[model samples]
Every structure is written in C-alpha cells, then in structure tokens.
Target: MTYHHLTIDELTMIANFRDQGVKAYRATKLLHRSLETVYRVYRFLAAGHTLQEYYQHYRENKAHCGRKAIQLPTDEVTYTKAKVAQGWTPDTIMGGHSAVVCGRFTAFSSGAILICGPCR
Candidate 1:
C-alpha cells in the first residue's frame, strides 16, 4: 500500500477531536487513519504543544530525511573538469593518476562518485 502524509486540515480535526475529549481510537475511525497515527498527534497535544508547533516540527524533520548533497571542494571540482577535458577517465583519476592534485575524491564510475567525497 502507498503511504501518504496527513494534511493540515486532518491535523486540526485531530486536535479539535482531542479537545472535545474524544478518544484517539474513535478519532482514527472517523479520519480513516491508523490508531497510532491519530494517537501520536493526541499524545503531542497532550504534552502541551500546539498543533501549529507539531506541524512546523514535522516539516523540519521531513526536510532532513535524504542523502545530503555531495560536498567536494572547488579546487577538486576544477581539477576533475580539467582532467576530463584532457581525455581522462574517472576511474584513472580516482585510481591515483592525479593523486597529487586530488587524493580526496573516492571511487568514480561513469563520471560520478559511488560515495560522496570530502570525508574530512
């Protein structure tokens, strides 16, 4: 089954339901959400946090869940481009051909690194 995030309206309804002393299980039945999903929001509100705060905090957490952007130094990017223009393969560059210019870049495949570089 596909997963979906709850919208702000549903979040507010959950908060309103809890405010009226409605139990989480019953609220879940009405919202078509899992008991745990509704209950998590209930528990957060029960902890004295506002629904807006929960939404803001939820968005912040979701934004952080991904591969961080690759971070190579400017000199390394310049060096890689120059070497590639000179008919050099990425494998040769990664395999110590230009170790003096950039020993920091990792394994390269099809012009892209298998893992992001700048380990330090």
Candidate 2:
C-alpha cells in the first residue's frame, strides 16, 4: 500500500489515547497502524503542551516531507527540456544510470532523474 501521513483527527485520537493512560500498542490495534507510527505521534509532544502546539509542529514538519523538487542547473534544465522537446525521454537522457559530468556522477533514480550533479 502507498504511504500516507496521519490526519489531524488521527493525531488527536492518538493524543486522547495517550491521555487515558492507554498504551501505544492499544492505539495501534484500534487505528490499524504500526506501533511506531502511533507512538511517534503519541510522543510528539509532552505534558503541558497544547494541541495547537502539536498541530503547529506537525505543519512545520510536514513542509519538509514529500518528494524533493527537481533541482538541476539552468543549463542542464535547458538541455533536458530541449532533449524532451525532440521526443527523448528523461530516462533516456539520463542513460538509465548516472549523468557523468567531469568524471563525477550524481545519484539519481533508475526510473527518473530528479537531480543531476554539476557536469559543466
């Protein structure tokens, strides 16, 4: 199954379960989530921290999640776009391996090239 972040309600429920002196394992069984997943949120905040504080922290942390945006130099970006306009696929341009520039290689996915190292 695809991964998904926890919702606010789920976070609240986890906090509630923690408040009731219930173990994280019990919340995991009820929430159909892994123990670590439930426990992480349960421990996201300590006593005396308000729910809003939890939410604020959640939002801030969420901003750093998700796929990192593709970051290539302007020249590379232009070259890739030009190659793409000519009917070449990204994987093909990436050579199904690494884009070696000046004898250096940047790690990229086999299926997609998100970023390339400085080849200039």
Q: What Cα-based lDDT does every candidate model obtain? A: 0.75, 0.68
lDDT tens digits, residue span 1-120, model 2 = 676777889888888988898899999999888898886676665656777787888789889865554465566656666776798865576673354332224423333344644443
> Cα lDDT for residue 34, model 2?
89
Q: Number of clashes in every candidate structure? A: 0, 0
Worst 10 residues of 1 by lDDT: 101-110
> Roughly what TM-score does model 2 have, to 2 decimal places?
0.52
Q: What is candidate 2's local distance difference test score?
A: 0.68
Candidate 2 residue 85 C-alpha distance from true site, Å: 14
Runs with alpha carbons beyond 4 Å of true place in candidate 1: 66-120
The numbered model that scores best in lDDT is 1
RMSD each, Å:
6.6, 7.2
